[model samples]
Target: MKKDNKCVDINVSANVGECAYSRGSTPIADEGDAVIRVPVELAVLNIRTNLAAKIKFPEPVLEIKDIKKRVQIVQCKLLLPGVAAGTDPFVEGSYHLFIKGYVRKNIQYASPCYNSGVCVNSEMRSLTTDVPFECVVEIAEDDFDRTPQLPFQNARAEFDFFRQQDLGHGYPEKDHFLSSDLSQFHQDSSQFYNQMPYCELISSRITEWDEALDRKPFHNSANWQEGTFETISEKMFLQFTVKVLQNQQVRVTAL
Candidate 1:
């Protein structure tokens, strides 16, 4: 069985936090200076799943050669600024902490069969045991007094765990045909323009016009009429202008 070419897999990890110690000394007149213990609190945060990986086709057809997991840390700050630093005692009170992990499953694509015009479909399996998960923690206003004791909580529900499944295979022949046509058009246009003597000059002038347009934006007209002839050019300048006019007309109709 033939397999599609494999691309390099990149693994990236995000930093969570570092542990640091703070020292404080108290002065005494009669006795020697006394040292006090100042314990640092671990940051607590919360995050929810906003986006999930799309299952290609009706199902996933790729094989999972390996699974990689990582945790991302998000920090939260107080809405009100200008407050004196170190005054906010609890780390949990100052910022919220959230963690999210990504799982990338590596799989090979089966080669297409030329004789029957059918592609050999195979399922992508996940070899990794750890699944991607998210966790969130919120520090209540009353929970701030006890410092040094980090208030870490498991927010993931038991039923919330998810695993990637292999869907069925798909034949992209139609997609390939459309893509080939687009490529041919681009190639022919390039060859024709390359043979033209004033191609460079025309392209340079177009670039200058594009830069000028960027400096001073203009709207495109969606529809226009010169006497009895109505023309609608799909140019950007015309389209923008036409869209504005259409919006105004819609507002007037509503009113």
Candidate 2:
């Protein structure tokens, strides 16, 4: 069967954390209990990878074939519960989110040499992985609605790749995708506990109550929709040990 040119499979992962803030903009004078809710929208803005070290080679290793590297972002999402208050007149609670990362790579061979002594050649190719996420920020109350500022709203999640296995050895020098980092892979997979149902907020207001005047749940969800972020903080070394051949003959001995 011929391969489908329009189909691609993607994997997703999650990250969760606990965050809380005090209820209301100011302290109250009445001893009676009251509740104030703050609403906000959450979304995944970007994904990034940091290479630990550059792939090194001797100046004469000109024909660097079977050279490949890969990176990607498989999943990104957020889950936060609505804030509520009781007798003590305070809001104390936490929430969690998910952010998964992945990588894909390809191999390329240097062109044949014609007339020249041994020389050094370096090549660099760039690629990116992007994931979109959306969620509602709901806070119900007696009157008025406020959208709280999202903490770490545009912060980047860092992924480590130093201990990853080499993807170049298993198969013949060729092109394919590999989930190279397993430890971190599982770490991201185990983040979601989902105690509360994720209410996909209606794109528009659902109630016409007077307090609902400013209840645009995800009015700005598209603000960061086109943004991309870095996931790995450092670059990993992608070294290759190659031999320079000349005249279809071995010019230097193998290491």
Candidate 3:
């Protein structure tokens, strides 16, 4: 391999944590034959969107339970070569690290009301059924154990370049969801009722009763009198699956 003088050497290990996972590192050597003991630091990875794939939401429907949240933690090991013993205990040779793992979420919901009152009620509800979605990180020898390098002085510059060159491309600017968008959809009940039949007034009354009985939001409640009905269609459920797989692949390949 073409040696880059700027490269730094270090040792790394992977660990999973709540909300965020970390890869710990310890420096075994440094440039100039200096033995350096670098403190262990966590490697933080982010979940991101896929630029090449399009996420499709099932037609607007009131009744269906979508995946509220899905999170995953994965670990991979790397090995470094060319070590000089008796050097400063802190100094470490360089090593290259590659991470691989799967992250996915499955959202599932029944189709919305096509007919006003014939088969299902009009009150909008969150689908109770879960959509099964999964993302896979194909495990291979390449995922584990790799070379090492010296610590780059300009870590951010190196990281930006590495992300651009090695990781899969980022999502398009338009496709990237803003914080407001996420918060708007996450944990908000108003959005659900708006999609269902009948005005918010009727939906609200029905939801009140449903909450009293189940202590949970009604996913498919048609009206206060109609009770809860299945609103999510099979097609919508499949869409969630596709989203999970596609997103996971995009994240892994990019990393």
lDDT per residue as tens, model 3, 1-255:
987885544434544556866985443322343333332231222223221222333344343344543322243333323223223222233323333323243545444445454355343333222223233332233322211232222111111111122223675544533233222222312111111011010110001011111212334545334333322223211111111100000111122
The clash tally of candidate 2 reads: 23
- Per-candidate TM-scores read 0.24, 0.21, 0.25
Best by TM-score: 3
Q: List clash counts for every candidate, in order.
A: 17, 23, 47
Off by over 4 Å in 1: 1-39, 43-50, 55-67, 74-137, 142-255
Candidate 1, run of 10 with poorest lDDT: 239-248
Report the Cα RMSD per candidate.
36.3, 33.5, 27.2
Report residue 99 deviation for candidate 3 (angstroms): 1.9
Write down the worst ten-residue block by lDDT for model 2.
Answer: 241-250
Over the stretch 74-130, how does candidate 2's per-residue lDDT look in tens digits?
433334343322222223333343434333334243332232223323443333332
The C-alpha local distance difference test score for the whole of candidate 3 amounts to 0.28
lDDT of model number 2 = 0.29
Error of 1 at 80 (Å): 7.7
lDDT of 1 at 35: 29
Worst ten in a row by lDDT for model 3: 199-208
What stretches of model 2 exceed 4 Å from their correct place?
1-41, 47-49, 53-71, 77-96, 111-255
